[model samples]
Target: MFFSPAQIYPFPGTSLAEDPEDIQKEVLENYAKDLPPIYLDVVQHADLSTLIWAPLMFRYPWNVVFGKLSKQNITVAGDAMHPMTPDLAQGGCSALEDAVILGRHIRTSFVQNGQVLVLKNLSEVLGKYVEEKRWHVTLLIMWSYISGWVQQGGSGRGMKFLRDAIFYKFLFLKMVKYVNYDCGKLDF
Candidate 1:
C-alpha cells in the first residue's frame, strides 16, 4: 500500500464543507505528481477512485503518565496499553509478548493456588504482568516514534544528516536489537 502525507487546509481552497471524495482526489493528485518515475508509473495505472484517506494515529508514550495498567483484576494489553508508530514494527510483536507474559504470570498463580482463580491472586498476577511490560512497552513507543520522525521528517539537510548518518549508521543496530527479546516459553 502506498503511504503519502496529505495536507488538510483549514481555509480558502479546501474547507470542511467540501466533499471528502473531492478533497482526497485533489490531495492524492497533488502529492502523487512529485513521485519518482517508477512509483508514478504504478500510481498512474492503478485504480485510485476508491482510495480511502485515513489519518495515521499514534500516541506518544509520554502523553500517558506511567501508572498502574491494572485496576483490580481488569487489565489491558497491546494497543490498549500502548499505541505506537509502525516504524519499529513491534506493535503486534509486543502484543504477543504481553499475552505470553500475562499468561506466564497467570499460569504461575494458577498452579500455586491449586488451579483456582482467586481474586486476590488474579490481581497480583495482573500487577506482575503490568510491571513486567510497562517499561518495555514505553521504550518501544518512544523508539518507534523517534524512528518514524527521523525517517519521514522531510528532506531537510539536518534531518537527512541525522537520519542517514546518525540513525542508519549508529542507532539502527540498537533499534532492531529488541527483536531478539525472548518473551520466554509459555509452557506450564
Candidate 2:
C-alpha cells in the first residue's frame, strides 16, 4: 500500500530496521483481510522468490487536499481565487477559462486608453470574473467530492449499485458538460 502520512510514514530509502520482519508480518497479516485479494501471476513473479514482499503498494488518502498554492495576488487567474478538489479535473481547465476571460478584459481596458491603467480601473473586471466563475467551480468541487465519497465508501454494495445505475449513467454524465468548455468566442 502507498504511504498514508508523508511525514509519519517511512519513505523510499528508509531503513527497514525501524520495523523488523516480525512487525511487518504481523501488520500485513492484520491488514490482508481488509485489502482486495490479488494473484501473484498477474505480473512476473520471477523476482518474488528473492523479495520479501510486493513492490508496489498504493495508499490513497480520503479527502486529501495534498497541497495548496496561492492562486491570486492582484492579478493571477481563476484557481488563485478558488481552491477546490481535483474531483472533476476542471482545476486547470477552469483556470484556463479564467485566464482567457481576464486577459480579454485587461486587453479591452488597456486598448480603451492606449496605455496600461491602474489596478482600480481593473477591479470591476476582476470582480466580474470572480462573480461569474465562482459558482461554477464550487459546484464542480462539490460534485467531485460527493462522487468520490460514494465510490470509496465503507464496503458499499447497494449504494454503489444505485450510484452506477442512476447517478453515473443518468445524472453525472450531463453534469460533466460544465468542465469540457471553451470560452474563447464568448461575449462575456
Candidate 3:
C-alpha cells in the first residue's frame, strides 16, 4: 500500500539475524503508532503475519556500487548497480531501463561485427553500456536518497520545514522528472 508521505523504518544490521516472525512482530510494534488507519486495517484484515522483506539498502554514488558498473565482460545493472530507498518509486523502473540499454548495446555490437560476439567484443560492448548508464545511475542514487530523506521527515525541525515547504512546493516535481527519462529504443 502507498503512503502519501513516505515512512522510514530502520533495521540495524544486528537485528536482521532474528527469525522472520520475531522481526515481523517487532516491526509492527515499532511502527504501530505511525501506521495510518487504512494500513492498520489491511494488516488486521489480511492477517499480515509474514513479511517478504528485502533490505532497502543504499550506497553512495561513488562507492563500490559505482566501481563495479563494468568489469571486462561482466556488467552490473538494476538493483545490483544502484539499489535505493523506495521513496522515489524508481528502483524497478531504472532496472528496466538498464536491461533495455544493455540489450541494445549487445545487439549493436553483434550487428556491427556481423559474427558471433567473442569475449573481447563482449567486454567492449559491456563497457559501452556502463559508460552510457553510469552518470544516469549516479543521479538516480543521489536523488532517490534525497527524496527519501525529505519525504520520510528528516532528523530535525529544519528538515521538517524544508520537507513541508521546499520539497512539497518545488522539489517533488524535480524528483518526478528524473523518473520520466527516455531510455530510447532497444532496437535488438
Candidate 4:
C-alpha cells in the first residue's frame, strides 16, 4: 500500500539527520497533517517505521522545449527524454514507445544502407528519432502534469467540483485514450 501526498516541498539533504527512522517519523508527521480521514486512519495504524521516502521530481514540459535531445550520433530515450508526473502512469509506456519508434527508425536506416554502419547516417537516424518523438513526448508531459494538478490541486469546494465533476466525467476518457496509441512494428 503506497500513498503519495502531493505538493510537498523537497527536504534539503543537509538538514536530514543520520538516523533514517527519525527522518521517516518527522516526514510522516509533517506531511500527514492535511490528509483526509481515510488516509489518516491508515497512517495511524500502519507500521511506517520502515517506510521509505523518495521525492518525485519532474521537469515541466515547457522547460524541455528548447533542450536538445540529441547530440551528434548519441540520443536519449525513455525518462531521459520526457520525465513526467506519474498521474497518467505513462512514463514506462512512453519509454517503451520511444524504444519501438527509435528502433524502427534505426532499422529503416540500416536496411536502406545495406546494413552498413555509417557515422553520418547515425546522425540522421537519431535526428529523425528525436523529431518524431518530440511532439508526442511533449504532449504526454503536459497532460500528465495537468492530470496531477487536477487530481491534487486543492481541497476547496470549487476545486473539488472542477476535479470531481468536470475532469473525471469529461476529461478522463480523453486523457486515457493515449493508451490506445500504437508505436508500430519494429520490422521494416
The candidate scoring highest on lDDT is: 4
Q: Report every candidate's CA lDDT.
A: 0.73, 0.52, 0.71, 0.75
Of the two candidates 1 and 3, the one with more favorable TM-score, higher being better, is 1
Number of the top candidate by TM-score? 1
Model 3 vs truth, CA RMSD: 6.2
Which stretches in model 1 have alpha-carbon errors above 4 Å? 1-52, 63-65
Q: How many backbone clashes does candidate 4 have?
A: 0
Model 1: how far residue 18 lies from native, Å: 8.0
Give per-residue lDDT, candidate 4, residue 75: 92
The predicted structure with the larger TM-score, 1 or 4, is: 1
Tens-digit lDDT string for candidate 4 (44-135): 66665665556656566654577788989999888888888787899899898888998999898888889876788898899989888888
Please provide, for model 2 over 91-122, each residue's C-alpha lDDT reduced to its tens digit, 9 standing for 90 to 100: 67777778787777767777776766656667
Rank order (by lDDT, best first): 4, 1, 3, 2
Give the winner by TM-score: 2 or 4: 4
